[model samples]
Target: MAFKLIFAALAAVSLAASSGAYQLPRSDQLQPLNPPIDNLIPLSAYIDGLLTNAERMKRGMGPARPSKFSDGSVTRREPSSTPTSPSNPEPTDVPTTTPGSGVIRIHDPSSSSTTLYWVSKDLNNFGEYGRTDDISKALTVTLGSDSGRFSIRTPSPACGCVSDLPFLGGIMGYATSGGDLKSSSADYAYLGATVETANGSPAVSGDNSFTRATGISKSIESSIWSISSDNSLTATWINADGAMVDAHILYYAADNVLSLTADPVSFVNNFGASPAVVSSWLSDSTLAVKATAAI
Candidate 1:
């Protein structure tokens, strides 16, 4: 009888141990989910990682994007860097695309830093200095009905890019480049536009533009000045119809200064349409659209 009782007690303990809380597991704190941003990551990737790790250790995580990434469970992606760096000058030993080639590498104009390829070769950025927008994400510039694309890595670079810093609200600032324009470019400075979630309200949305160049950046600046607008800053550039003009802006950032520039637009003339004209192109007889910035 004693042996029988002891055996029953032991069996009960064994069952409990096999199905204890530790065994069941804690589903609430699931492991972090990581998505591949392709091999050879960029500063943006690293910045993304740091923010994610920091956020993951917290409670009540939110979405990544309103379109897709937002609803999925929150998980941190690794920053494509050494996990840390000082301001822009500190080089984060990361991978990069060759210059004038592709973006295994890119230059951060704001600080002349670098990292791997986040650049979009939408048009013909050629990944050179002063060839594309400095503030916006790699532009999706296009040319020819065939739908080709290219990228501009930096207005200027110092090898690697400044480490990505998500907490800073997308590197708040206006980005001006010493960049030039290319033929395989877009009518607008940039496209495939995306709005900032934080900057939401009944007001003006952020906008960037490109035009066919009629004059030099220095000359255009002289003719272009702001008159007035409800918005904080207004910049204007001068160019002729069928010329390439480069102008870009990124609003709702953490900074005040606006980076601005103008370069001539280009045309492969896919249809060979009478030597490519601006969206608002005019005949010589008609007024060349009065050059004025409204208040």
Candidate 2:
């Protein structure tokens, strides 16, 4: 037991002496860890070396060796010229994508059929409409001896253009001959309240002034024409099958074109059957009106 206790005591004392808790060493025991410094590169030269190699490294090239003759000035390399080929010609101005402006619609009262005419404008969508220096000249349409194209039911079937509408012929006639329809007080001269079968069928207004066109026949049954307070003219008619056809024609001097809009208003108002909703040609490209809830 005594031998074991003595061995433990000696072991504790030996650990304490080797644990770095002893007194410090004298200054004579230390030595220099590095060689004497000399011949160091100047701060400017070191910085220039770094800068020179930085540009080369960025360009994926090896750094140049330091030279005594180098002025340490950075020289930028010019960009390489791009090769030109026939397949890669320079770009040019892009063409315009706008559509033509003027359009006209024609309707047939007998058939309740309608046709669209892009009058004055390019029907082929090429670019623009035909420019008319004088709209008065463009509207000067002379009456013809041929039966009217707009006739409903008679010895001859319907035939005529929008200008052939009742009362329009005299208006166009006077306009072409340098007569202003707006200032004309010839109240009941050209037309009367009722159709004068003796004379060519002329469109009569509520005030009884009617004008005759050459081709229009007097066989119209349920046709009515009215002039609005603003001088805008509208003609309504019922087809053979009771379809309501309305033609609204207005003159726009600024655009030098006549805007004629004709459509079938109430198919069931006269015919008594719920007609199918008119689907637009744009339906194919349109999105659904009712949106679905997103997940």
Best by TM-score: 1
Q: Which stretches of candidate 2 lie over 4 Å from their true place?
A: 1-224, 248-295
Per-prediction TM-score: 0.19, 0.17
Return the TM-score for candidate 2, rounded to 2 decimals: 0.17
Backbone N/Cα/C clashes per model: 42, 10
C-alpha lDDT score of every prediction, in listed order: 0.24, 0.25
* Worst 10 contiguous positions by lDDT, candidate 2: 152-161
Tens-digit per-residue lDDT, 1-295, candidate 1: 9999999989987888888723433344322111122331222221233434434223122323222356666544544546555576432332122222212112233443344223322211111112223322332211111111111112213323221110101111112222232235322222211122121111122211111011011111211222222212122333333232334432111111122323222211211111111111111122112223221
lDDT of 2 by residue, 59-144 (tens): 23246544453777656433236733558532222111112111112222334534322112110011111222221111111121
- RMSD after Cα superposition, model 1: 25.9
Predict model 1's lDDT versus the native: 0.24
